[model samples]
Each structure stands twice: as structure tokens, then as C-alpha cells.
Target chain A: MSTNAAKNLFIYGSLLCFVVLVILTIDTMGKLDKRAPEITEEVNAGKKVWHKYDCIGCHTIFGNGSYFAPDMTKATERKPKEYLKKFLLDPRVIKADSAMPKLGLNEQEADDLIAFLDWTSKVDTNDWPPKPILASAIAGKAASAGQALFQKHDCSACHQIQGIGGAAGPDLTQVGARRPDIDWHIRHLKDPSSVVRDSAMPAFTDMNDEELKALAEFLITLK
Target chain B: MKYQSHQIALNFYTTSVLLFLVQVLVGIIAALQFIWPDFFILNFNTIRTLHINSLVVWLLMGMMGATYYVVTEESETELWSVPLGHLQFWATVIAVGAVVVGYIVMGLNPQANTEVFGTRLLNEGREYIEAPRWADILIVISVLLFLLNSFMTVMKTRKFTAVQGVLLGGLTFLALMYLPGMFYTKSMVKDQFWWWWVVHLWVEGSWELIAAALLAFMLHKLLGTDVKVLAKWMYIEVGLVLFTGILGLGHHYYWIGTPEYWLWVGGIFSSLEPIPLLLMVWDAFRTTRETRVPVQNRIGLYLTVAHAIFNFVGAGLWGVIHTLPQVNKWTHGTQITTAHGHLAFYGAYVLLIVAMIYVTVPSIRGDKEFNQSRGFQSFWWMTISMVFIVITITGAGMVQTYMERLLGLDYVTVKATYNLWFWIFRAIFGAGFLVGVLMLAADIFSIGKRPAS
Candidate 1:
């Protein structure tokens, strides 16, 4: 259902994305006020997580080599974004036997990962999920709070979290239970920035400590 | 005096306020989780359910209460039937009760606990949708009667003030939005789409109508502020929020996998929606700056002004930071989004309710100067606490987002990265909110007068 993280050329390309939007409205740019750019935030969060953990030390992406972990030449295909985001939260979540460190990704930054990893998994690589030899990366169910999230975030009317809901996202039917807590959920949830560079999961830390803890607990429970 | 809906109004108000206290508890717990992933009641599914369900229930209760109060005044008649009102109230309780049962008891059952709570929820919460559907039914039925009751009263003897007009409009939309929320489908996208018509539209859309109505009535009565001026401001506020707020719907679309167009639409529109609220802050301050006329809810007014300003900065300014399609493309559903939701909700929704309490509590007591000293002092403390929470949360979220996204780190690492700040900030904010709540409780309970006849 997913692909390995592909070394995207977009890191550099994403900067251009901002440039294009600004250039199009360059004339009224001054007239237009500055607001936060959340779409980019998800990706940036992911990128930051990637950097903070020194992922490059253990993994190679876009062909800059590494022998420690699998090459991310096609990581997007390897796991779903949920898998990636969760993995970043706790590497051991995905592979309890993994030697990789749990990089301590907070719950809010983790949500940014779904879109970023979704993008990464969709990279136009020749082969997908990178390791056909490896079992398919399971889909992480929508966080148990997924539906509540839909409601709390008002995601239901536009995007369904579970069945009996909206139509924006695919039903998170086994996203949690099925999806492995490997590189997919953990890495993506952490920043989503490294892979896609521009994502939509805004920083969820705006929620109070209680909300974040509860939401994270709920989302993680999806499996 | 024809409308005996005073009881209905009082009942709804009572229920909503209590629910708000519940919401506060849930909110506090949720925030604590972010700071300490393995803290008390760390079960994600249960906690998330508590946070979200309580928020919806409390907000709905408040709207229902406000609606009953305003409609009776507008129509000058008893709600069509007291029996019907009783039914709706009970139905709402049952429905919310069902939802709670599912979330805390069933949804978060230990078998469902996976690694981190968020993921396990994704996995296990899905299987439990059927249970909550019963609650949904009660909500629909109760709301239907509510809408009909409000409309019936209005149609019979509609005396519209700018205040009442806003109330009428809000009640109408509340009815319209519910129809779409009833669909059953496998598509998360479609599900989310329809739900927002209920949730988002309520806050940004219809609920605002209610807010405006409540505010208008409260203000006019308190200060004899000209309804005409208030109406004009309300009109502008609604215009800006609608034009841009509808686009604000796009903010929910980013990670849902609907289409890229939403990214642009949601990103641009929602980002801009906060502008009106920002302007509202300026307008309120501009209007009130020179006024020496103090009212019962002067503290409430302070809270209202604070809400608008924070809504501008927290929800508007901060929301725009990553609300763009490109940014949403990257930042969606992350801790970054959480930060945005926190400040935005607190500034926009919570503050309004706080202001409402300040206003209504005093009015009931017939005191022009309600707890003047304590109320004013409490208002300052609450605002300061709000600022502190928003700043720390935003800062922590940004750090997490950057660390995870840019660097490709894991979740645990990000948590560890900002570990100290998260704990300290959350604890501080939590303590402040608790204090404010205590003061407010005292203010309301004391009532500042002898027992009513």
C-alpha cells in the first residue's frame, strides 16, 4: 500500500514553491499580510526531526550513501505516512528489535508526517517501498482519536477518520494495527520536512499538555 | 413574559457551564500528555476522546443555552412546548453520555492500547464506531427539535434586533449543518467534509451567529450601547469570516487526501479569516478605550477583547504561518497543527465563553458593578496565562516540527529535545488556568446578592 522514502529533489524544489506563490502575488505582497505557512510546517517539522536524530548518520537518502540503515532511495514506498510518523515517535515502536534510537518526537509534530510520508511514498521511483523483500509496511490505523480528531479538528465533514463519516481521506481502517511502527510513522511524524519539504500537518503543540498527551495516546492506540 | 423559556435558558446554561468545566479538565490532561508522553491517564484513545467529545458537548450545550435564552426574548413567547424542551435536553444528555461511555470505557479498553496512544487509537478506535452511532442519533433528534422550536417561536412573533437577528441566523444554520453530518461512508475525506459543516461552520459559521447574538444582547442591556453600531460591526465581522472562513475550511483538508486544490483554497482562505477577528480586537479596544462606563461584565469585556486579540494572533497570525497549501502540504496533522489549534481555540472559543460567564453571572444578580475588583484582577491573570501558554506551546511545537521534519528524527527524540520546556510551560499554564477557574467558580456561586424570590 506504500513505498519507501524516496530521496526527493524537492528539498531544494520546495523553496521554489514559496518563491512561485510570492512571485505570483509579488505586486500585492506588501498589501497582503504575513500569516503562518502551515503546509510547509509539516515538512519542516519532519526535516527538523530528521536532522535532530542524525538520520543521515544511519541512513542514506537520495543516494548519499550510508550502511547503517536501509537506503531511503525509495523509503516513501516502504511504509505509510502513519507508519513513518509513529516510528519517529519511537523507533522501537516499529521494530522493537531495532537498534535505532527512539528520537523522542512529540505527538503534534508527528501528525505532520502523514502527508509528508504520503508524498514520499508516492515518489516516482522505479521500484516502490524499496524493499520488496521486506513485508509490506502495514497501514497505521487512524489514531483512536482519529474520529474525535476529525470532530475536534473539524475533519469529519471533509475527511472521514473512520467509517460513517466524511470523504476527504481514505478510511484509516487498520492504519494503526496494520501499519508497522518503523521508519514511516516515526520519521514523518517527527518533521515531515526532510522528505516532502512542504507538508500540511501544522504544529499540534498548540493543544495544551493534556490534549497533546491524550491525542498522542489515542493516535498511537490505533494499532 | 409570554415565553416561559426562562427555565430552558437557565437549564441549558447550567449544563453548558458544567460541561465547560469538564472540558477544562480534558484540555489540561491532553496538554500534559505532550509534555510527558508517559504521564497519568496516558491512554491516548481515552484522553483524545475526552478532549474532543467534551469540547463538542460543551460547545453545543452553550449554544443550546444561548439559543433558548435569546429565542424566548426574540419571539416573546414560550418555546412551543416545555415538554419538547425537556425531551431535547434529556436527549442531548443521553447522546453525550453514550459518546463518553464509548471513549473512556470501551474505546480505550486496554486491548486497544498499542505502542504510543495515538497509533493504537488509529488501530483500535475504528472497530468501535458502531457504538457511538447511537449517541449520534440522539444528537440529531435533539437538535432537530431545538431548531424547530427556535424557528417556530421566531416565525410566530419575530421581533428582530441586530442582536436577535444574529441569533435567528445562527439557529437557522445550526439546523442546516446537521443534515450533512448524518451520512455514512467509508471515505474519510467525505466524512470530514460533511462533519466540518457541523463543527467548523458552527464555530466559524453558525455558532458565531449565536455568539454575536448573545454578545449583542448582553452588551446592549449592560451599557445601553447602540444596537445599530454593534449590528454594523457584527455584519463586518461575519462578512470577513465567511468569505475567508469558508476557505478556512481548507485548513482541515491538507492531510486528508481530498485534492491539492483544497490545499490552496483552505490554505489561503483560512489563513485570511483571522483578519476579521484581528480587526475586531482593534475595533473593540478602539471603541472601549476612552469609555469610563463600567458594566457588570467589565471583566467579561476584557476577556472578550482578549479573545479577539488572541484569536487574531494565535489563530489568525499563527494559523497563517503554515495555513498555505504548500506549508500545509508539509505541516499538516503534526504537533505544529496542534499548536495552532490550541491558541486558536482558546482565543476564539474559550475566551468567548469566559467572557459570557463574566457578563451573564453579573446580570442575573442585577449588579452593575459585579465583583469589580476580583473580576478585573482575574481577567488580567487569565489573559497573561493565555499568552504564556500560547507562546510556550507554539515554540515547543515549532521546535518539534523542525527537528522531526527537517532532520528526520524520531518522535521520542523530539519529545526529549524540548522535554524541559514542555513540562515547565504546561505546568505553569495549567496552574494558572486552575486559579482562574477557582476565582470564576467563586464569582458565579456567590451570586453577589441575597437569594432570589
Candidate 2:
């Protein structure tokens, strides 16, 4: 083909492609615009906190940031509010080995962050970072009681059971496989320093016997 | 050099080479940090940001230099304003240096890090376009100065070659794309959507045009091929590039809170992004085979051909592997992406710039015996090392995806499982790549002393 003809073909083809891109971009933007949640003051403040600290430098949100830490897109659904608050204020309080430094956020800042995480949890991520097997394992009345105890004791603040929770502690998804003895877990939970010397884990002496048994049973089902 | 004004390009080239060395050193630090997180006092983010920002800066410097060199020669005239060109070059150097220093300081003072600074300074945490607002402004001004100098030179001669037109067009688009990265948005989705305009468009769209123009100019000079024929091929390549690449931006949007339609749009268009590159490879080989005169600078031809071939493999082939939405679900942000990034950047931009430097340095230095055997060794070492790096990283990424994403293993387990690949990557491929870069530096700098030939 002649050079001018090729040039014309290219110019026209590119123009056509640009038209298509514009249409698709408009359509996608419109959809996203509709999906954008109302920017409440709390959510905005939370987003500010997120950026001020550059959370993206360490954690992935919707699969965009560094992979050194877990994805926080579903943080609200993954961990309870109190646990998230404590972890945010002092990551080591829950997970002794957490790489997340204490951001020294005030109580209000921590609450704002939770609101932001809550908003993020509602985002349609197309079922990404799939749910943990422990979710299904912890079912029924006994599991419910154990879950309440787990939240009250802020267990998820340290131990990640699935794709959720902090990374400082060991993932409890397979805790049952390692320590199957219920009696051993009960004793260990009451006083972690007794079983493992130099254990950074805080003991759960405040829990009653019934609550301890339920939590132990719940952990056993993690396998 | 053909024109006295061509000396301006030498300044840019020297700066580019120095920055290239810094980029490689920072890259080594980044790779080591993956194994030993606390190895350097500089955080991983800072080192990585420096590595990428330096790469972009040096490559731009190289392209600017190549543009001046090619335009002057093609027009058969001196630059429009040698002083203006020098001014732009210096301004660019200072601006880039300040940005690098800012990143280091911010890394040290993470608490004081803020995204908002009323546009006077905005040190964003975004990848690639991490330059603050002031740096962005300086860059835009520098690019404007360059475009003015180049366009003025071409217009004065009244000699608008197809090659010059394509390159100038590409450079113009490159400057325009940088605008999107300067703006701040509240939504991460919107922020990323525009970031690809700067990133993907440059690599896949405009930069390819620049590369093709340089390739054609080099071939025309070396092989004495028909400029008309080369121009025709360039037009075709530019057509394919814009047609596929503009829409190919969708590939990045699939997981960044964009609509689902990107799944199909990104897959189909991005898969076709390699056609122009493949065509360039074919054209290069055919022209060489038809050359009646023996090639004098074998290293130049080797790097040019390697640029085309490796661009196809790195950007074209590997890019398509995970470009599809289905596959991307598994490999997005994984080592697979890193593999593609390493190869694609080296293949498309790095090697092309080196090819331009290799072919042009002889003329710039007035050296006849420039193509030493060590040049060829550098070529093989860099190419082979890059191939191994891509292979190892791809393997690591695939395993991580399978174990973590598919099998529901946690990030820590998958990371531990792939420790061996990281070691291999640092010890072998990383070292080899660094050595190759240093050898190329030695080859380029040692051009004047050619045994008094």
C-alpha cells in the first residue's frame, strides 16, 4: 500500500479507537459514579487518616498497594470494631509481632478509620481474597457463643483466622491441627506464658470456664 | 556530529547514563529488601520509588537527547535554540534531583507525610508518578521547552520527514499524558484510572511511536534503506499502537473499582498490542538481510534487533498472559506482574534508549572503531540475565497465586514457600543484570580510546 494510504488508515483507525475508548470510559465512569457511596464526614475523615499515614505503602486495598501486608479492603467485615480500634491504636497490643507501627491515632481517629473500613467492606470486590475455611467451620450455637467470646476477648486483634485480622499472631485457620488437645488449649489460653515461655500473647484470665470451653471448641473446629 | 547544536544532546545523554547507574543501584537495594526487610535504613517504599522514578527520568532524558539528535540530522540543520535546549536540560536535572531528595527525606519522616499541600508541593504516594506537584510543573515546562525547540527546528528547515512527525507526535502525547498524574482525586479508583493514562499510554502508546521512529532513523542511516518505505511501516505501526493501546488502558481498570466491561475490552485490545512490535522485528531483519554493504556497527544492529524481539516477548507475550480478566484475577499484583514489568521496561524503553546511544555515540564522539567485542558481551549478559529474571519471577508469581489465592493459603505461608526464588533472583539474575549495565557503561565511556584507529 502507498505510504499516504497507510498513514490515512492509521489516523482513521486511531480516531475510531479513541471514540470507542471515550464511550467505554464514560460508561465505566458513570457506573462508578453511581456506585460511589455518600461521603459522610466520618468516612472522609477516615479516608484522610488512611492517606495521612500512607496505609497503601504497606497494605493492599482492592489489590493496588504493596503486598507486604494483608488486603484491607474487607477489614470491617473481617474483624470486629473494637478489635480494629485497638489494633489501629497499637498493633502490638493484639499482635506482638505486627510490622504495622503504632500510628498514635486518637480515639476519634480510630473510630473514623473504622467507619472508612466499614465503607470499604461494602465495596463490590467480586469475591476477592476468598473467605477463609474457618468461617464455615465456626457455625451453629456453640460457634456463635465462641464467636461472642472471641470478639469480647478481642482474639482477632492478633490471630488471623482467614484473610482477615492482624498478621502479628499465627493464623488460627489450622490451630486445631497443631494443638488438638482441648485441655492444653484451655490451660494455654488462661496463661499463655505457662505453656510457652517468652510468649508475647496476653492471657485471657477474665473469661469464665463456660466461655473458655466454647472458645476452645471454636478453635478446634478451625481445621 | 553533523551540526554544532547537536552537542546539546551529549549533555542529556551523559546525565541519562549517570541516572541509569543510580537506578540500577537502587534496584539492587530494593531486591535485597525483599529477602531482608531491615537490610537498609531506607524503607522499601523509598528505594522502590527512587528506582522507578530514576528509570523514568533517565529514559525521558535519553528520549529527549535522541529526539534532538535525530531531528537535527533529519532536517539537515542546527537546533532552533541551542541555549533553550541546554536550559531545559538543566532545569530537568535539578527538578528530578530535588524530587529524589524529597522522597528520601519523606521516607525518614513518615509521620509528617501528607498528600495535600495546596499544590505548592504534593508528594503523592502513587507509584511511578510519585513526583510532587512542583516537580510535575517543572517537568511540564521542560517538556514544553523541548517540544518548542524540536518543532521550531523541523519547521525552519521545511523538511518534515515521516519519522520526525511520528516522533514529535509521540513526544507531544507524552507531555499531555503527564497532566493527568498531576491532579489529586479523593477516590482511589479515579486516581488509578488516570494513572494508567500516564503509565500505559507512554509504554504502549506514545513511547512505541518514539521507539519506532528511532528504529527507522537508525536503519535508514545504517542500511541506506528507503526512507519512504520505512515511513510507511512507521505509519502502520503507529496506527496499530494507538488503536490498541488507548483502549488497552482498560486492562488496569479491571480490579481498580472500575466497571466489569473492562474484562473484555482490556483483554481483546491488549492482546493485539504486540502486532506493531512484531512487525518492527520483521522489518528490521528483512532490511538487514537485504543490505548489500556489510554492517559496520554490529552492536548497534544487535541492540536494535534485540529491542524489537524482547519487546514482543516481554511487553507483548507476558503482558497478554495475565491481561485477560480471568487470569488477571490470579496474577494481578503478583510476581507475574513484576516479571512483566522488568522485562517490558528493559525491552521496550531501556534497550531502545541504549540502542540509540550505541548507534549515535560513534558520531557524537567522532570515533570510528566504537563497536568493541565487550559491547556484544554486555548485550548477551543483559539479555540472558533479563530472561532468567523474568522466568524466575514468573514462576514465583504463579506459585504464590496458586497457593495463596487459589488454595486459600495466607500471605505469610506463600511468602515463605517462595523464599528460594527470591534468593535466586537476587544472587544470580540481579547480579548479572547489574554487571551487564556496568559493562555497557564502560563500553560507552571508553569510546574515545580506540588504539589510535
Per-residue CA lDDT of model 1 for B1-453, tens digit only, reads 234565566566667667766766766775665555445543433555566557667767767766776677556777777788877888788777755664554333433323232122212232112223345556667888888887777777766555666676667766676666654433323434455556666667666556555655655554666666666676666556566665466566444334445556676667677677776777667556645676545566777677667767776787788777665544543455556666777777667666666665554445445445666666666667767776776676677556544444333444544445765786678668766666655555654354323
Q: Calculate model 1's interface RMSD in Å.
A: 20.9
Put down candidate 2 lDDT per residue, B96-169, tens digits, no spaces. Answer: 88888887777777655564564323347677876777788888999999999999999988898999998999
Off by over 4 Å in 1: A1-76, A79-223, B1-4, B35-38, B76-78, B107-131, B193-198, B286-296, B365-369, B448-453
The RMSD (Cα, Å) of candidate 1 is 18.1
Tell me the tens digit of each residue's lDDT in model 1 across A1-223.
1111111221223234334433433432232222112235565445433433334433434322222244343444423455466566776544454445554557775665454444334433222112211111212234354435434653332222333222222334455665545445444444545533434333433455555444444544555
Off by over 4 Å in 2: A48-54, A81-114, A129-168, A171-212, A217-223, B115-122, B448-453
The whole-model lDDT of each prediction reads: 0.54, 0.78
In candidate 2 chain B, where is summed lDDT lowest over 10 consecutive residues? B114-123
